[model samples]
Target: MILLEWILFLFLFLGLVFLMGKYMSSVYLGEDTFFTVIGKPLENLIYKTSGINPAEEMNWKQYGLNLVIFNLLGCLVVFLLQVIQGYLPLNPIHAANVHWDLALNTAISFMTNTNWQSYSGESTLTWLVQMLGLTVQNFLSAATGMAAMVAMLRGFTRKETDKIGNFWVDLTRGTVYILIPLSILFSVFLISQGVLQTFHPYQHFYTMENQSQVLPTGPVASQVAIKQLGSNGGGFFGVNSAHPFENPNGLTNIFEMAAILFLPLALVLSFGYMVGNIKQGLAFLISMLVILLLGTGIVWWAEMLGNPLLIKYGIAHGVSMEGVESRFGVLISSFWGLLTTATSNGSVNSMHDSLMPITTLVYMFNMGVGEVVFGGVGVGIIGMLYYALLVMFLAGLMIGRTPEFLGKKLGPREMYLSVIALLVPPILMLIFAAIALMIPSTVGCMNNSSAHGLSELLYAFLSGAGNNGSAFAGLNTNTLYYNFSLGITMFISRFVTILPALAIGGSLAEKKSIPESSATFPTTGILFIAMLIAVVIIMGSLTFFPVFTMGPLLDHLFMIHGKVY
Candidate 1:
C-alpha cells in the first residue's frame, strides 16, 4: 500500500508538471502586454517620481558594474545587521550578536539569491534582523536575479544595441513595480492566515498541553512573500516555514507554496513579452513545469511509502508515515519538498534525510539537473536558458546544421559557455563532498547504507551550494567545514552561472533576430519543448553519472542487500 502511494504520487507530480508546461504555452503565450500591465504604467510612474527615462538603455558594462555595486553594498548591510542584532530593539529573545563568520555566511547566502542559512531561525536571529537584514536581502536578491534575467532576455530581443538595459533602472523597477507590490499583497494574505506580524518578541504563556516551548515570532508575513516570490528560500525560522509561528496553518502553507511559484510562472509570461515571442517564452515555461512536477512526485511518493528499511524492521508500525508531520500531511509536505529544492528554496518540513534512497536521489537530481524549472524567479528562467542553448547546440551538431536559439547563432563561443555553465556545479559538488568525507568533520547515518550516508552529506552541500536550499537533513551541516564549504559553493553556484549567462546575454543582444527559414527549428512548439526536456535529462545523466553511482545509485543497490554493490 505504501509502495502504491509512492507510485501514485510520482505519477501525479509528473502529470502536473507536463500539464502546467503545456498550459503556460497554450493559455498565456504573448497574450498580455507588459507595457500595459507593467511597462508603460511603470514608465509614467518613473518619470513622475524621479524624472528618469524608463525607455532609455544603458551599456552592459554599466549594467554589470551596477549589479556588482548593489550586491556588495547589500552584503555589507546584511553583515552589519547580524553584528548589531543584540542591540536592535525588535529582538524577541534579545538573541546575542551572532559569531562574525556565521553572520558573513548568512549575509552572502541571501545576497546571491543563495539563501543558504547557517543558523536556526527562532534561537539565533532577532526579529529586527530577520526583517531588516535577511528578509530584506530576500527581496533585493530576488529582484537582482529578475533584473539579470530581464537583461538577458533584452539581449536576444534587441538588435545592434550595446545596451542590455540599465541596472539601476531595472533594479528599481523590479522592486517598485513588480516584487514589492506582489510581496505586500501576499504578505497581507499570510498575516490573515494566522502567520504572525509583530514588533514584539514572542509572547510566552503556560500551555494546557503541558510542554515547554518558545513560541516563535517574527515579521514573517513580509519575509514570507519574497522568500517565495524571490525564490530565495531563506526561512524565517530554522526549520523554515515548518516552525509553527512562521507558517502556522494549511492556508498559509498553500499561500507560501503559491508565493514560491507565482512569480516564476508569471515571469514566463514576462519573458515572452520581452522577446516579443509568446511561443519562445511558452516553450521555456512548459519545460520548467514539467521538471518541477517530476521532482514533486518523487518526494510525495517517497514520503508516503514511509521508509522501506523502517517498514522492514517494523520500527514504524502505523498505517501512515511517522517521520512526517501530521499537520502538513504527506501530500503537502511532499509538494513543498519538491518545490523548495527544484526552485532553489531549501527549507524542508518533513526531513529529507529520513526519506528512502530512491526518494533521496530524486531530490538531489533536481539540483543536479541545473535547477532551472521555475527556478529562483530570475535565476531559474536564465539558468534553464543556458541548458536550452546547450541542447540546441548538440542537436545542431547531430543534424549537421548551425544551431540557433531565438535567431542568434550559437557558435563555438556560445556553446562552450553553455557547456561550462552546465558542467561546473557537479564538478564542484563532487570535489566538495570528497573533501568533507576525507575529513572527519562530516559524518552520515550509521546504520543506513554507506552509499546512502554519503548521499545524505552530498545532498546537503549539493542542495545548499547548488542554490537549491532543500537538504537531505540527516547530515549535520552547521560545522565550520559546512559553514565555509557550502558557503563557497553557493557563491560559485551563483556567479559562475550568472557570469556565463550575462556574457551570453551580451552576445545574444549583439545578433539580429533571424526570421524563420527552411533550417529554422521552432523553439515554441511541442517538438522543441520535448527536445529541451531530453536535453536537460541527458546533460544531467552524462555529467553526474560517476558521482551518482557512488551515491544514490549504490545506495539503492545496497538497500536491496546489505553488502556494497
Candidate 2:
C-alpha cells in the first residue's frame, strides 16, 4: 500500500510539481499575456469565418448558444449522410441507408466524441459517407473536447470574468492550428505504413492459400487522423484498428498510440500554461498517470500471463500469440488496449473478448477511472482538475484552513460543481451495467460463454458510456439491444461529464488566479498527487469492484476450474 502510494506521487503527483516549474517558465519565457496566446488566433478565426472582429468580450449565454447550435447543425449534417448513403458513390459493400433512430444516435455520438459505433464499418458506411459523416465528426468532437478543457483552464486562471474565452475561437484554434497539422502529418506517415487512403473499393487479391481473399479499403487516413487527434476513438472499418489497412505496421501502431495520447498528454502543458500555475497541471497529469500506469501494468501483465485455465488445458503460455493480431504483437495489442481505454480511442487490433477474464475486467476498470490521465482530448485533464480541486477543498476544510490552488480559493460552489462533473460517468456506468446483468432480456447477450461471457456485455456498456469505444470482442454485438445500449452509453459518456465541466470552467474563469499561501495545497509536489491517486483508486474500486468481482473474478476462477460458468 505504502509503495503504491509513493508510485502515485512520483509519477502522478510529479505532474503537479512539473506544473509549478512550467508555470514559472511560462511566466519568465515569453512575457506574453493570456489574451495574446488565446485572443490573436481567435481573431484570425473570426475574420476567416464571419469577416468580422470578435475583439469585444461576449456573455456566457452567447458563447454557449453558438456552441450548441454549431454542434446541432453538425449532428443534422452527419445524420443525413448515413441515412442517405445508398445514394452516395464508392460504396463497394453496397451499404444500405441507416434507420432513423440509429442515424440520429450515430450523428449525436460522433458530434459528442463518443463514437459509439453500432454497425460494422465496411458494410455500413459508404466511402463518401464515411469521410463526410463519421470522419468529419471525429475532428469536430475532438475540437469540442479541447475547447471545453481550455474554457475550464480559463476559469481557474481568471480573477473575474463572465467569459471563458470565446468557445468558437478556442474550438477553431484547437482544430486548425493544432489538431489538423498534426493529423495531416500522421495520415501521410500512416500511408507510408501501408494504411489505405484511396477511394478504392474492397479489393480481392489471390493468395497462396487459394482461398477467396477479401480486403476492405477506403479514405482511412482521414478518419484515422481525428480519431486520435480529437481523442474520439471511432474506427473506419468494423474491426477498427484491427484492420490491416487501418493500422498497417508496428511503427504506425506506435504513432497511432502516441496520437491517441499526445494532446491528452500535452494537455498537461496547456493547463499549466493557461493558469500561470504549472504545478496544478503537473499534479493532475501525474495523478492521472499513476492510475493509468497501474491499470496498464496489470492488464499487460495479466494478458502476458495467459489464462491459468489455458495453461492447465495444455495451452501455451507466456504469450498467446495466436489469439491476437499478427501485424501487431501481444505487447503492442496490450499497449493499444491500455492506451485506448486510458484515452478515448476505441479501435481494437487484438480481440479483447478473447483475452482472459481477469484481463477484461482490468480494461473496463480503466474506463471506470473516468479518463483523467491526459484524458481524451479536452476531457481527461479537465476532469482530473475538478477532482484535484475537490480533494484540495476537502483537505483544506478538514484542517480549518482556506483552500488555495495556484491563486484561487476553493469554495463550495466550485467543489459541488466539480463533484457533479466527476460523478456522472461512473454512476451511469455502474447503473447501466448492473441493469444489464440482472435483467434477463439484456443478459441474453451471454449466449455463449459463462460468467466470463456475461462480463463482456457489462464491459461494452462501461466502455461505451465511458466514451472509450473499444469492446470485448467475444460477443456478436450486431443485435438491436447492443446497438441501443451502445448508443445510450455513448451519449451519457460525453454529455454527462461535459455539462458539468463547462459549468465549472465558467465559474472558475470568473475568479482571479491567487498567489500561494501557507494553506495552499502544494498540488505539484508528490503529496497531493498521491492524494488524488488515492481518491481515484478508492472511487474506482468501490464503484466498480463488486460488479467486476461477480462478472470476472469468480468467472475466471470457474473457467480455471473447468466449470465454465
Candidate 3:
C-alpha cells in the first residue's frame, strides 16, 4: 500500500510538472498565459501604485542592489510587526511582544526564505501577526527567490546584453501568477481535508483523565498551502505538519509532500523551456531525482530495520515508530523526512531527532549538498546551475576546452563566483558549529550528549546556512546566542550565494555567445547527468564526510553496541 502511494504520487507530480513548467515559462517570458488576462491588470495596478515601471530593465548591479534593499526592508517590517504585534489588532489571546533577538532571527529567516522557527506558533503569535508578518513574508520571500532565479536565467539565454529582467516585474509576476493562484487552490483543498482555518481562540477543555488540554487552532490551511507550495516551511502550529490540524491524514500528507517539490521541480523544466533546450532541463531533473530517490531509499531501509538496540532488547515493533505519527507509519514518515530535507521545505511529519543515525546523515547530507536536489523554489535551481558551472569548469579542464553553459562562456569570473557560492554555506556551517561546540555554555543548549548531541548542533547550523529551515528538534535554539548567531548565519549564507550568482549573471549577460565548437562539452546527455550527480556527491561528501564520521557515523557505531545517546 505504501509502495502504491509512492508510485501514485510520482505519477501525479510528474504530470503536474510538465503542465506547470510550461505555464511558468510563459509567465516569466512575458508571453500570453492563462493568468495574464486577470494578472495583467492587477500587475499593472501594482506597478502604477508602487511607482514601478514594468518596462524598465536593470543591469546586474542595479538588480542586485534593488533586490537586497527590498528584502532588507521586508526584514525590518516583519521584525517590527513581531515586536509590536501586541499593540496591533486581532490579538484575541493578547500575545505579548516577541523578544528582540527572536524577532530579528525570524525576520531574517523569512526574508531569506529560510523559515526557521524558534518559538511555537500558537503560543507566541496572534492571528494578525501570523498573517501580516509571517504569511506575507512566505509569499514575498519565495517570490524573491523566483525573481533572482528568473534574472539569472535571463543572463544565460540572452547574449551581449547588460540587462537581466527587472526585479520588481519578476517578483510581482511570480507572486501574482504562480504562487497566489496555486496557494489559493491548495488552501481550498486543505480546508476540505479538515485542516483548520479559523480566527477563534484556543479551545480549553478537560480530558478523560481530568487533564487540561488546549486545542490550539488558527488560520492554518492558508499558511500550510503557501508554506508547502512556496517552500516556506514555518508552521502555524508548534510541531509543524506533525500537528494534526496542519496535516490530518494520508491524503493531505501525500498532497502536501507533493506540493513541497512541485514548483521547484517544475522550475527545472521551466529552465529548459526558457533556454529552448528541453533535454538540458531533463538532465537536471533526472540528476536531482537520482539523488532524491537514493536518499529516500536509504532512509526507508534504515528506519524499517528498526533500532538495533531496541531489537536486541526485544522491545521493538515492526518499524522504528518512535516520534512518528501513527497515522502515516514508517514509510510515509521516512519519505517525508527525506523529501522535506531534500528540498528547502522544512515541514516534517515525523520527529527528525528520533531518526536513525544513518538517516540523520542522509538528511544532513541533503542540506550539506546545498539542497539542490530540487531545492527551494527558485533558488534550488540556481544552486544546481552553480554546480553545473563548477562541473563544466572541471570538464573543460579535462577536455582541454573553454567551458560554456547554454552558449554563455564560463570564464574565470564565472568560475570564481560559482565556487564561492557553492562553498560558502558549508564553510560557514562548519565554523559556527565548531565555535558553538567549544563554548562550555553551549553544551546546555543540547538535549542529548556525545555523538547524537553533535548531530543536533550540526543539523541546526546546516539547516540555517543551507537556507533549509528544518531542525533535529533536540536543540534549544531560542537562547540569545543561537537566535543571533543563526540569524547572522542565515543572512550571510543566503546573500553570499545570491549576490555571486547575480554578478555571474551580469558578467555572462555582457559577453557575446561563444559559438558551439567541437571542443564544447555537451550538457544534455547521460554523461552530463552522471557527471552532475557525481560532482554534487563528491563535493558534498568531500566537505561533509569528516563531520559525518564524527557525528552520525559514530552514533550509528555506538548504537550497534547497545549504547544509546
Candidate 4:
C-alpha cells in the first residue's frame, strides 16, 4: 500500500508538472494562458498604480539593484510591523511586539525566502502582522526567486544581448499571474479538506478529564496554500504542518507534499520549453528525481527499521513511528521529511530530530548539497544548472577538449563565478558550524550531547545557509547568539549565491552561440545526467564528510553498539 501511494504520487506530480511547465512558459513569453483574461488586467493595474513601465528591460546590474532595494524595503516594513505588532489592529489574542533582534532576524528571513522562525507563530505574532507582514513577504520573496531564475534562464536562451529581462516585470507577472491564482485555488481546496480559514478567536474546549484546551485558529488555509505552493514554508501555526488544523488528513498531507514539489518540478520543464529543448529539461529533472528517490528510499528504510535500542528493550514495535503524527504514519512522514528538505521547503509534518540517525544523515545530505535536488522553486533549477556548467567544465578537461554548454563556451569569467557560487553554502555552513561549536554560548544551546548535538548545530547552519528552513528541531536557536548569526548566514547565502548566478547569466547573454560541431558536448543524455549527479554528490560529500562523521554517521554507528546519543 505504501509503495502504491508513492508510485501514484510520483506519477501525478510528473504529469501535472509537465503541463504546468508549458503553461508557465506561455506566461513568460507573453503568450495567452488560461488565466490570461484575469491575469493581464491585474498585472496592468499593478504596473500603472506602481508607476512601472512593463516594456522597459534591465541589464544585470540594474536588475540586481532593483531586487536589492525592493527586498530592503520589504525588510524594513516587516521589521516595523513586528516591533509594533502589539499596538496593531486585529490582535484578538493580543500578542506582544517582537524584540528588535528577533524582529530584524525575521524580516531578513522572510525577505530572503528563508522562513526560519526564531519564535513560535501563534504566541508571537498578531493576526494583523501574520497577514500584512509575514504572509505578504511569502508571495514577494517567492516571486523574487522565480524572477531571478527566469532572468538566469533568459541569459541562456538569448544571444548577443546585454539585457536579461526586466526584474520588475518578471516579479509582477510571477506574483499576479502565477502565485495568486494558484494560492486561491489551493486555499479553497484546503478548506474543503478541513484546513482552517477563519479569523475567529481561539476556541476553548474540555476533555473528559476536565482538562482545559485552547484550539488556535486563524486564516491558516490561505497562508498554507502559498507556503507550500511557493516553497515559502512559513507555517501559520508554530508546530507547522504537523498541527492538525494545518495538515488535517492523509489527503491534505499528500496535497501539501505535492504542492511543495510542484513549482520546482514545473520550472524544470519550463527550462526545456524556454530553451526550445524539452529533453534538456528532462535530463535535469531526471537527475533531480534520481537523487530525491534515493534519498527518500534511505529515509523510509531507516525509519521503518526502528531503533535498535528500543527493540533490544523489548518495545517490540514493527517500525519506529516516534515523533511522527499518527495519521500520516512512518511512510508519509519519511517522504515529507525528504521532500521538504530536498526542495528546501522546511515545513514539516514530523519532527526531524526524532528520525533514526541514518535518516537524519540523508536529510543533512539533501540540504548540504544546496538543495539543488529539485531545490526551492526557482533557485533549485538554476542552481543545478550552475552545477551542470561546472560539471561540463570538469568533463571537458577529462576528455581533453575546450568546454562549452548550450553553445556558449565556458570561459574564465563564467567558470570563476560558477565555482564561487558552488562554494558559498558549504563554506558558510562549515565556518559558522565550527564557530558555533567553539563558542560556549552557542554550544550551550545544544539539546543533546556529543554527536546528536553536533548534528543539531550543523543542521541549523546548513538549513539557514541553504535557505532551507528545516531544522533538526532539537537545537534551541532563540538565543541572541544563534538568531543573529543564523540571520546573517541566511542573508548572505540567499543573495551571494543568486547574484553570482545572475551575473553569469548576464555574461553568457552577451556571448554569441557557437554552432554545434562534432566536438560539441551533448547535455541532454544519460551521460550528462550521470556526470551531473556525481558532481553534485561528490562536491557535497567532499566538503562535509568530516561534519557528517561527527554527527549522524557517528550517531548511527554508536546506536548499533547500543550507545545511542
Candidate 5:
C-alpha cells in the first residue's frame, strides 16, 4: 500500500513537472503565458520603480555584483526591521524588538534563502515584519536563486555571448510570473484546509483541560505558500508546519510536501525546455529521484523497525515515533523529513532530533550531498549540474578524453570553478563543526550528550553550510556565538556556491558548441545516470565519512546496546 502511494505521488508529480516546466520556460522567455498577461504590468512597474533596464544584459561580473549588492541591501533592511519592529505599525501582540545578534542572523538567513531561524517566529516578530521583512525576502531570495539558475542555463543555451541574462529581469519575472501566482493558489488551498490567514491579534482560547492559551495567528498562509514554493522553509509559527494551525490536516500536509518539491522538479524539465532536449532533463530528474527515493525508503524503514530499546521494554514492533506529531503518523513524518531536507526546504512536520539514528544519518547525508536531490528550485538543479561536470571530468580522465558538458568543452577554468563549488560546502561544514566542538562555550548548547549531541552540532553546521535551514531542534542555537558563526556559515555557503555557479555559467556561455562525436560522452543514458549517482555518493562519503562515524554511526551502535540518547 505504501509502495502504491509512492507510485501515485510520483506520477502526479511528474505530470506537474511537465506542465510547470512549459509555464516556466514561457516565463523566462518573456512569452505571453497566462500569468505573464496578468503579471507583466506589475513586473514592468517594479523594473521602472527600481530603475532597472529590462533590456540590459550583464556579463558574469556585472551579474554577480548586482546579485550580491541586492542581497546585501535586503539583509540590511531585514535587520533594521527586526531591530525596530517594535516601533513599526501593526503590532497587535507588540512583540519586542529582536536582539542584535539574532536580528543580524535572521536578516542574513532570509536574505541568503537559508531561512535558518534562531528564534521562534510568533514570540519574536510582529505581522508587519513577517510580511514586509521576512516574507518579502522569501519571494526575492527564492527569485534570486531561480534567476541565478536561469542565468546559468543561458550559458548552455546561448552561444558566443558572454552575457548570461539580466539578473534584475530574471528576478522580477521569477517572482511575478512563476512564484506569486502559484503561491496565491496554494495559499487559498491551505486556507480551505484550515491553515490561518488573518491580521487579527492572537486569540485567547481555553484548552480541553481549561488552561488559558494564546493561539498565535497571523498571515501564516500567505507566507507559507512561498516558503514551500520558493523553497524558503522558515515556519511562521515556532513549531513550523508541525503546528496544527500551519498544517492542520492530511490534505494540507500532502499539499505542502508536494509544494516543496514542485518547483525544483519542474525546473529540471525547464532545463530540458531551455536546452531543447527533454531527455537530458529527465536524466537529471532520474538521478535526483533515485537518491530521494532511496533516502526516503531508508528513513521510513528505520522509523518503522521500532527502536531496539523500546522492543526490549515489550513494545511489539517498537516503532520510534517519539518526536513525530500524532496527527501525521510515522510514515508521513519520515517521508516529510526526507523531503524537507532533500529539497533544502527545512520546514519540518516532525522533530528531526528524535528520529532513529539511521534516519538521522540519511537526513544529514541529503544535505551533505548539497541537497541536489531536487534541491532548492533554481539552485538545486544548478548544484546538480556542478556535480554533473565533476562526473564528466572524472569520466573523461578515466577514458583519456577531454571532458565536455552540453557541448561546451570542460576546460581548466570551468573544471576548477566546478570543483570549488562542489567542495566548499563540505569543507566549511567540517571546519566550522570542529571549531564548535573544540570550544567549551559552545558545548552548553546541546540538549543531549555523547554521540547524539555531536550529531546535533554536526547537523547545525551541515544545515547552515548547505543553505538548508532545518534543525535537529535539540540545540539551543540562540546564543550570540551561534548567531554570528552560523550566520557567517550560511552567508559563505549561499554565495560561495552561487558565485562559482555563475562564473561557470559565464565561462560556458563564451564557448562555442562542438558537434557530438563517437568519442563524446552521452549525458542522457543509463551509463551517465550511474556515473552521476556514483560521483554524488563518493563525494559525500569521502568528505563526511570520518565525521559520520563519530555522530550518527556511533549513535546507532549505542541504541542497539539498549542505550538511548
Candidate 6:
C-alpha cells in the first residue's frame, strides 16, 4: 500500500508537469495563452503604470543589471520593514523589530529565492510584514529566477542577436500569469485542507490537562501556498510544515510535496518546448527524476533501519520515529526531506536532526550537488544546463570535435563560465564551514559534539550556499556570527553563479549556431541521460565525498557501534 501511494504520487506529479509545462512555454514564448485574456491586460497595466516598455529587450548584461537592482531594492524594503516592524500596523501580538543581522540575512535569503529563515515567522513578524515584506518578495524573487532562466534559454534558441528578452516583461508575465494564479488556487486548496488563514492574534486556551496553550494563527495559508509554489520554504511557524496549522493532514503533505517539485519539473518540460525539442528536455527531466527517486529511496531505507542503540536496549521498535510526525510517519517524512532538499524547497515535516545519519547525508548530498535534482523553479533548469554544457564539452574532446548543444558551439568563454557556476557553491560551502569550525564561538553553536556536530555546521553552510533553506534543526543559527557568515555565503553563492550564467548566455547569443551533422552527439537518448547522471555524480562526489567521510559517514559507522553523538 505504501509503495502504491508513491507510484500514484509520481503519476499525478508527472501529469501536472506535462500540462503546466506546455502552458508555461506558451506564456513565456509570447504566444496567446488562455491566461492571456486576463493576464495580458494586467501585464499591460503594470507596464503602463510603472513606465516599462515591454517590447524593449535587453542584452545579457542589461538584463542582469536590472535584475540585480530590482532585487537589491526589494531587499532594502524587506530589511527596513523588519527593523521597524514593531512600528508597523497589524501587529496583533506586538512583535518587535528584528535584529539587524538576522534581518539582513533574511532579506538576502528571500531576495535570492533562498528563503533561509534565521527567525521564525509567526513570532518574529507581524501580519503586515508577512504579507508586505516576505510574501511580496516570494513572488518577485521567484519571478526573478524564472526571468533569468527564460533569458538564458533565449541565448540558446536565438543566434547573432544581442537582445534576449526584456527583464521587466518576463518578470511581469511570470508573476502575473504563472505565480499569482497558481498561488491563488493552491491557497484555496490549502484553506480547504484546514491550513489556517486569519488576522486573529494568538489564542489562549486550557487543554484537557488544564495546562494553558497558545495557538498561533495568522495568514498562514496564503504564505504556505507560495512558499511551496515559489520554492520559498520559510515557514510561518518555527516548526515549519511540521506544525499542524501549516500542514494539517496526510493529503496536505502529499500535495505540498508535489507542489515543491511542480514548477521545477514543469520548467524542465518548458525548456524542451522553448528550445524546440521535447526529447532534449525529457533527457534532463529523467536525469533529475532518477536522482530524486534514488535519494528518496536511500532516505527511506536509512530511516527504516532505525537506531542501533535503541534496538540494542530494547526500549522501542526498530523504526526511527524520534522526531517524525505520527500523521506522516517514516515513508512520507523521508520522502519530504529528500524532496525539499532536492528542489531547494526547504520546508520540513519532521526534525532532520533526528533522522538517521545516512539519511542526513542523503539530504546534504542533494544540496551539495547544487540542488540540480529538480532544483528551484527557474534556477534548477539553468543549473542543469550548465552541466549539459560541460557534458557536451567532454563528449567533444573524446570525439575530437567542437562540442555543440542545441546547435551552439561550446567555446572557451562558455566553458569557463560554466565551470565557475558549477564550482562556486561547493567551494564556498567547504571554505566557510571550515572557517566556522575553527572559531570557538562558532563551534559553540553546535547542539551535538563529534561527527554529528560537524554535520550540523556543514549542513548550515550547504543550505546557504546551495540556496537551500532547510537546517539540521540542532544548530543555533540565530547568533550574530552565523547570521553574518551564512548571509555572506548566500549572497556570493547566488550571484557568483548567476552572473556567470548570464555572461555565458550573452556569449552564446553572439555566436552563429552550427548545423547538426553526422558527428554531432545526440542529447536525447539513454546514453546522454547516463552520461549526464554520471557527470552530476562525479562532480558532486569529487567535491563533497571527503567531507561526507568525516561527517555523516563517520556518524553512521559510530551509530552501528552503538555510539550516539
lDDT of 3 by residue, 1-565 (tens): 9689778878877998899999999999999987889999999999999999889999999999999999999999999999999999888778999999999999999999899999989899889878988999999999989888889988888888899989999999999999999999999999999999988878999999999998887889999999999988999987999999999998999899989989999999999999888899999999999998899888877887778767655765635778899999877788887888888998888889988888989999999989999999988999999999988998989988888899988889998899999988889889989999988788688988989999999999999998888898878999888998899999999998788878888888888887777767899888899999999999999999998999999998898777765
Show pairs that collide, candidate 5: 306-318, 306-319
Error of 1 at 153 (Å): 0.9
Rank candidates, lDDT, best first: 3, 6, 5, 4, 1, 2
| Residues 127-229 of candidate 2: C-alpha lDDT, one tens digit per residue | 8778878877888888887777776666666668877667766666666556666788888888887888887667898889888887877888878877876
**Each candidate's lDDT (Cα)?**
0.73, 0.72, 0.90, 0.88, 0.89, 0.90
Question: Which residue runs of candidate 5 sit more than 4 Å off their true CA positions?
Answer: 1-9, 312-314
**What is the per-residue lDDT of model 6 for residues 1-565, given as tens digits with 9 covering 90 to 100?**
9789879878877888899999999999999987799998899999999999988989999999998999899999999999999998999889989999999999998888888887778778888888999999889988988888899988889999888889999999999999999999999999999999998778999999999999988999999999999988988898899999999998999899889989998999999999999999999988998988788778878887888788766746678888889999987798899989999888899999889999999999889988999898888888999999999989988989989999898899999999999998888879889988889998998999999999999999999998989998889999888898899888888887678877888888988988888888999989899999999999988999999999999999998887865
- Pairs of residues at least 3 apart in sequence or in different chains that clash in candidate 4: none
Off by over 4 Å in 2: 1-47, 50-53, 476-478
lDDT of 4 by residue, 1-565 (tens): 9789879877887888889999988888878988899999999999999999999988899999999999999999999999999888988788888999999888888988889887888888888888989899999999998888889888878989989999989999899888998899999999999999888898999978999988888888999999998888988987899999999999899899999999988988888898888999999989998998889788878877778788756666646767889999887798898988889788999888888889989988988888898898789887898799998999899889989988788788888988888788789778888888888988888888888888889889988988988877878898887888898999998998789878988998998888889878899989999999999999989988988998999988887778854
Candidate 3 wrongly placed segments (more than 4 Å): 1-6, 208-210, 316-318
Point out the worst 10-residue segment of candidate 3 by lDDT. 310-319
* Steric clash pairs (candidate 1): 21-286, 92-201, 109-115, 121-238, 155-509, 346-469, 346-470, 353-472
Per-model TM-score on C-alpha atoms: 0.87, 0.89, 0.98, 0.98, 0.97, 0.98
Candidate with the larger lDDT of 2 and 6: 6
Candidate 6, poorest ten consecutive residues by summed lDDT: 311-320
Query: What CA root-mean-square deviation does each model show from the true structure?
Result: 4.9, 5.2, 1.3, 1.4, 1.5, 1.2
Clashes of each: 8, 22, 0, 0, 2, 0
Residue range 437-555, candidate 1, lDDT tens digits: 88864663222447877787778777765687776555667777787888788778777777677777787788877787977877788988898898888877787778778888787
TM-score for predicted model 1 compared with the true structure: 0.87
TM-score of 2: 0.89
Q: What is the lDDT of candidate 2?
A: 0.72
